[model samples]
Every structure is written in structure tokens, then in C-alpha cells.
Target: MKSFVFRQFEIRQSADVFRVGTDGVLLGSLADIRNARKVLEVGTGTGLISLMLAQRNPKAEFLGLDINQEAVELTRLNFESSPFHSRLKNIHQDFKTFDTQDKFDAIVTNPPYFEASGSEKDKIARQTVELNFRELISKSSELLSEQGVFSLIIPAESGNDFMKMAQENHLFLIRQIHIKGIEGSKNKRLILEFSLTEKALEESEFIIEKSPRQYSDPYLELTKEFHVFKNRS
Candidate 1:
């Protein structure tokens, strides 16, 4: 697998772990972490999102968790190699049973949403076999500080259900970004931010591309600090 090179750090990928992708990039770029002093990433595939978040918020410390042993090792390597390594840590543990006394100011994840079993390469990292929406929401609410935010990128179709589940757990929707793969296409993904406190909701839309192969200006600008593109002046 090719390593994803960011301006200040590089994400080393592994075939056994979920590769860095658009969803993780978007979460890392767009997740609300400005006020966060401690952040927890639920499904740290390659530690890409946490690395991006750490780079974005210099004062934030990060802890990543993964159930898969391979992913844990992979994230460890990526975190140790990053410039913000001193503030990053990861563990191999299933989030459901993982206990901690520390509360996080931000909990971010690019979670696997597939409910049906698929014969995919990284099935555990790509399916909800181990962790379901209900468990994730309940656990996040417990782990978050009073003013903490929980953020993630998942299928747009699942947004309503996720928000509802979050609400049941006392996590209210605060921000939502409807994401389209291309102009004129339906919103396929959603970036959601929730908090324990009820506040005014922030909503927006993002288009990844204007055409099939061309990136939109908004997408480019949002990721300009991280992605190293070719043929740029």
C-alpha cells in the first residue's frame, strides 16, 4: 500500500488495515476540535484522522483505539512516525469493553457502516459486526466531557437514525455536512458532529468533485494544507 503523505506527516498503510480514504480525510479536516484538549478516535484504522486532527489542533493530545491487532500495530507505527507523535497514543482493545477515567473533549471516528456481511478484504474494519451504532453512541456519550463533541463521517442515509440514537443517549446533533460525490449527485455521505449540550445546529453541504475526475474548489481548499497534489504552482 502507498503511504499517504501530508504536509507535516505521513500515514503508513498496511494491507491488513483499512487504507486511508476520503472519509477519514474529510473527518480529520472538518471535525470540530478547536476547543479540545484531549481527543479520542474510535476506529483508528491507520491513525490518519487522529494525525490530521493533531496537526490541525496543535495543543490537543490524541488516543486511538482499534479492535483488530493488525490495525493497532499499524496505527502505532503511523503515530510514532508523525511529527505530533509525542501527543499520540494507541491501544489494541475493543471499544465496548474499554474503560477509562479520563473524559475527552472530542471523540472522532470514520466508522464502518456496512451492516450486511460482505466478503471484503478488511471485513472487520469495513463492517459493523463488532460495533453497532447504538453501542458507539452510548459509549461516546459516556467518554465525552460535558462540552465535548463527537464527530464522524458515515453514509448519508444513516444520518437520521444515527442522530436519533445519539439523542437517546443525550448527544444532540450540533453540526451536519451533507456530502456529494460530484455535482448534481445525491448526497452520499454525512459528516455529523454531536454534543452533550443542546445548541444551535450548523448545517452545510460539500461537493467532492465538479466532474468525474476533477476536484471541486471547495474540496481542494478544505484539504490544501494536507494533500500534496501534483502539478501545483
Candidate 2:
């Protein structure tokens, strides 16, 4: 597995553990963490999202939870090796069974959106075999503070269903970012944020590429602080 090297930290990957990808990076970079002091990451794959959040908000402390033991260990290693080591922590625990009286200022996750697929490694990280959308919404509603926000990156097709479930849990949609793989392409992903308080929804679109293999200006600018792209514009 190829490690994702950032300006301030590195994500060392293992073959069995889920690798750092664009989705995690997008959530880390785009998730609103400015007002959050205590953040909880539901699925800590390689610790990428929390690490990026920690870098973005120096005052924020992060706690990561993962059902997979190997992922938890890998996330711990990545967190310990980063500059924000003191502010980051990870545990091997399933979010479904996680019982915490402490409320998080921000609950973030790149949830398992894929349906159940028979596989041994990394299946739990990608599929909803253990945790589904309804479960995630219910637990997040219970764990988020009054002004706390629940944020996630998921497939475009799943957006409506997720929002519906969240609304049922009294989580209002606050922000939504539609992601297009190409400039003129249909949305491929959505970066969503929900809060307890009802507020005006903020909607926006982000394009990942201008053309094949070319990063869009907005995408490049959004990730400038973290990405160490060669010949970066």
C-alpha cells in the first residue's frame, strides 16, 4: 500500500487496512470543524479524516472509533506518528454498541455505504454489514451536543435516504456539498452536515477534476494546505 504523504503528516497504509482515499481527504478538508472543540470520528480508517481535522483546527481534540481491530491499530499508529499525536486517539469499538455519556461537538464519519459483499479484509470499512445508515443516524442524534453537527461523505444516490433518516432522528440538514468527478459530470458524492437546531440549508458544489486526470481549481485550492502535489498550481 502506498502511503499518503501530506505537508504536516503521513498516512502509512497496510494492505489489509483501508487505505487513505479522496473521500476521507474531502471529509477532513471540507467538514466544518471551526467551532468544534471535541470531535468524534465514527470510522477511523487510517486516521486520515481526524488527522486532517486536527491539523485544520489546532484546538480540537479527536477520538476515533473503528469496529475492525486492525484498523484501530493502524489508526493509532498514524495518529501517534503525526504532529497532532497528543490530540488524537483511536479505539477498537463498534459505533453501534458504543455507549458514551460524553457528547461530541462534532461527530464525523465516512460511513460504510456499500451493501453487504462477502470479503475478508476491508469489507467492514466499506459495507454496511455491521452498521447501517439508520443506525448511524440514531446514534449520532443521541451523541451530538446541542449545537453539535454530524458530518459525513457518502454516495450521491444515498443522499436523499440519509437526509430522510436524519430528519426522522431530528437532525436537520445544515450544509450539503455536491461533488462531481468532472466539471460537467453529474454529482458522484455528497458532503453533508446536519445539526440539532433548525437552520437555513447551505448548498454548494465541488468539482474534483476539470478534465481527465486533472484536478479542478476549486479542488486543488480546497486541499492546498494538506496535499503535497507535484507541480501544484
Candidate 3:
């Protein structure tokens, strides 16, 4: 697919990089960006999440970083074509080695969760060969401002371990939502938000579909601002 049209912006995905998916969309739409003046997105594949955040927070400046040159180019193109281009920037750099004196008010990512199990492209895009959960949490802790928030969506199976690692780094979980494919399906993904300050964890569940090819009401309502669907009544 060359491009995908959202309610506010159109994303160009001509480059052979990780394309936008449900996980990215969910994280982008659900992540809290209130009072965020500056935001950083690690592994910003095609800059989908950053673009969404830009649309949501017009005053916020965004920087999207990715190790893959192709992904960087694609994100740059996407950012440039959007209305919030002036507020957005895309850089070709690994998050681990990316040096910046500035800290962000919010850091978001949908990282590679699986261990290597697919093609070269898949491995680079889906596996944690470059940045694992531990390093990701540690780096976010270092680069985030005192009141900054870090948000991500990961596999449900790894949720407990990820929370443990985050706690070890003093990044306390503030909110979380478990995602299921259907009403009765197993939880597949977990969307979590963390902050440096300790707080009570708020938990919830999100179901994507009520039936085959039919979106659940909650999912539709949550994403109604961005996505246009048929028979959403």
C-alpha cells in the first residue's frame, strides 16, 4: 500500500519499512499527551504514532527516531506532508546511541517484542535485536523529564516481565489496558503508561471486535476520531 488516509492526515508508506498497524494506532489514540510540550518516539516506524500525537497536541513538538534509514526516510516524508510538519521531525538514529541534551515530556514506542523468528525485515522490525525492553526502559528513564510519561504497547505474555523491569528502573506503572481481539478471545497485547513518580495502577480491557470483521462499539468509539468505518452504527 502506498498510503493510508486517516481523518486528519494521510500516511505515505512507499518505503519498505514496518507499516502502520492496529497496535500503533491504538497506542497513538490512547496515550495521554496532556501538557506535553515535547515528545519523543523511539522506533517510530513511518512516524504514525508521532503524527497522531501531533494531531492531538498541536502545541507539542515531536521527534521520531529510528535506526533503519528506510524507515527514517518514510517517516520524514510522512511528517513533511502533514499539516503539523513544522512541529515534527524525523531522525535516522538508534535510540540507544541517540545523544540529545533535551529531555522529552512524553516518550512513546511500540517496540519489537518477539525473539527472532521471521525474515530479515521481520527480524529487524519485530524482534528486539537492537533494543530490548530493559534497555528501552532504562533509556526512557534517562531521557524523560521529571514529570514525563512513557507509554508503550507490548505482547500480553511479556507484560508482567516488562512491568518488573520497569519497576526495577523506578518507572512505576500508572495505567494499563489489556487488548483482546474479540469479546471472548485471549488478551494479546497490553498498553501501558508509566511515570517516575509512584502512583496507583489503573487497569482496563479493550476488545477490538465483537464478531468476525465487525468492530466492537468501544473500539469504534475510541478510534472514531481517526478512523472511518462502514456500518459503525
lDDT string, candidate 2, 53-130, tens digits:
999999999999999898899998899999999999899899989988899999999999998977765788888998
Q: Show where candidate 2 strays beyond 4 Å.
A: 119-121
Query: How many clashes does each candidate structure show, in the order listed?
Result: 0, 0, 0
Kindly indicate the candidate among 1 and 3 with the higher lDDT.
1
Residue 28's lDDT within candidate 2 is 92
Worst 10-residue lDDT window for candidate 3 reads 116-125
For residues 59-148, could you state the per-residue lDDT of candidate 3 as single tens digits? 999999999898998899888888999999988898898898998999999999988665676566799899999999999999988888
Against the true structure, candidate 1 reaches a TM-score of 0.97
The 0-to-1 C-alpha lDDT of every candidate, in the order given, reads: 0.92, 0.93, 0.90
Better of 2 and 3 by TM-score: 2
Backbone clash pairs for candidate 2 read none
Residue 212, candidate 3: Cα error in Å is 1.1
